[model samples]
Target: MQVQKFGIEALDNMLGGGLRSGRPYIISGNSGTGKTVLALRFLYEGLKMGEKCLYIATDKPPHSTITSISDSFGWDLLSLNVMDAVPTPSLYSTVYPVRDVTAKGEIREISEMSKNVEKGELTMESIILKLELEYKEKFYHRVVVDSFTTLKRFGVEEERRNPVMAKFFRFFVEKGSTVVLTVEGNIQKIRPELILSSGAIHLKREVQDMEEKRKIAVLKMRGSFFDPIEREFIIDKNGISIRKVKSK
Candidate 1:
């Protein structure tokens, strides 16, 4: 089986070298636990390997929000294909063009998908359609969706979340892309995507010895052996790096 590296050396080792490729995985954590950073780092690894990568920015606007975050980390994200699916104000037209930040640092509008998008809203259905069109032309080796939490709140109706996400993952696998989706919450909060994912890496903030610490753990990985230990990590000038595994 092929594998995908997380780009964090110790984490790669914890997953027994790397995660299995061509499968969907979830990065679940509460706010301030480095979910977005970890997701971007995973894509950075793909970039280093010279693989085609895509980032779906659903939590915030891609132009300013994502670029600013990447800039702070000193990671040039120009080479990564980014789809701006962030919801716009209802005052805007629903028939807006689907745009992407191309490699040349320019926003290029793609084909129009609809004339009536329900108050110019970006919905789960439209996002899936855009992805389908994207895959038909060029395939991405790795794809990251910033946070499912925001998408859940605005993109889809609550009742249809499961089947829609299941379809999303199914299409993702069929395209042979290794996916990492960020979810804002804990492993205890059961979600449809978590169950649909091939594996899940959880991040959390814990207080030990009177200091708050960041930790990462692989809750479950199908068809693979993992360290099964919660490990300490830190985010600094170089982004997320494992410090040490928790003592058993």
Candidate 2:
């Protein structure tokens, strides 16, 4: 497996070198835990190495998300193929149809329609196919899906969606791309059907005496060794930086 550097010495050392190639890893955390920042750093590092990077955002528009982060770093995120998976107003009804039992008979209808609801709007499998075709020989080493939680908002049950997540994971793994997916830990604990499909790492915020601190720890890695300690990390102008926590 090819190891990709994160541009942070302590973090690189913790993983024996860096993230392994062709593996799907989850970065779970709550809001303000710097999950998005971590993903950007991973892509930025890959871009520095001349590897193509793709960032798929389901929650916010790609431009807005990129603009907010690009000012903090020197990375040219616009140069890369950034896509917004949010559905347009016109295609919402056709893409997502909900079955409803009215007085007449059972009828399928689009419920709570909105341009922002992307639940059944985009397919991860289709996105991968498009990327493969666009970046044919360039070799895209890194791919980031901003948040899987947003993708699940389309009313698909966990049991039904697990297969989709699994297929998406396999698609990238087979293509030899290091994929990073952000997930909400609290939500995953409640509905864990997708947990079985990929390796997971939990990022938690520790509050002590009203002060908050962030920590990153590996919950599981499919077929490789990972540091067991919950390392402290920070998101600043440059991006995410991690340091090992001393053992007591």
Candidate 3:
């Protein structure tokens, strides 16, 4: 496996260099855990090295998300290519009548529609295929999927969801892109074992007396040796930094 720099010196050393190149990996954590910041930092590093970076966002508008990060981290967001397909209010309105339904019912219906959007009924595969055709020889080296938990809105039957997730993974691998996938920790119905059968890195964040802190651990990495211990991490203006947890 080719090693790619993670952009954090200590964490890079911990990985014996950096993340393995051309592999699909997960960065799981609850909201406010800095998963988005970490993933963006990884992609930004690639962009700095002249590697084409692709960001696939499922939750927020891609431009808005990039703009927010660019403002905070000082990365030239315009340099990286972003592809996003998220559930839209108009799309939801088309699927179900929001005004007539109860609030809970409306939420449930919209959620289902959003999952369908992510599953590629909204043309995610077609968009990706087009990107692959255009960038195959361009040597695009980094890819990030903002969150995978959105797929659960389609329903928890693995039979329905796994195939879509698997297809997306296959596309990324075929393109030989280093990919990072994000997932919210509270929702476990989709099962990391299913989505991350290829590999994963789990990130957890906790707040102690209003100060936020993070923990990083590798749940799985197919062909590389990595430290499995959960360690502390911080997100500053520059990006994410990880520190080894000292044993008590």
lDDT tens per residue, model 3, 53-92: 7776667766667777888878775677654446554222
The better candidate by TM-score, 2 or 3, is 2
What lDDT does each candidate get? 0.76, 0.65, 0.65
lDDT of candidate 2 over 56-122, digit per residue (tens): 7766656656667887776666455554565443221222121101111221112323333344465
Steric clash count of candidate 2: 0
* lDDT, candidate 1, 15-125, per-residue tens: 877879899999999888988888988988898899998888777766665565676788766687777666653122223332363222223222245553554466566
For model 1, the stretches where C-alpha displacement exceeds 4 angstroms are 89-116, 246-248
Superposition TM-score, candidate 3 onto the true structure: 0.75
Model 2 regions lying over 4 Å from their true place: 88-120, 125-138, 155-158, 187-198
Show the colliding residue pairs in model 3: none
RMSD of 1: 4.6
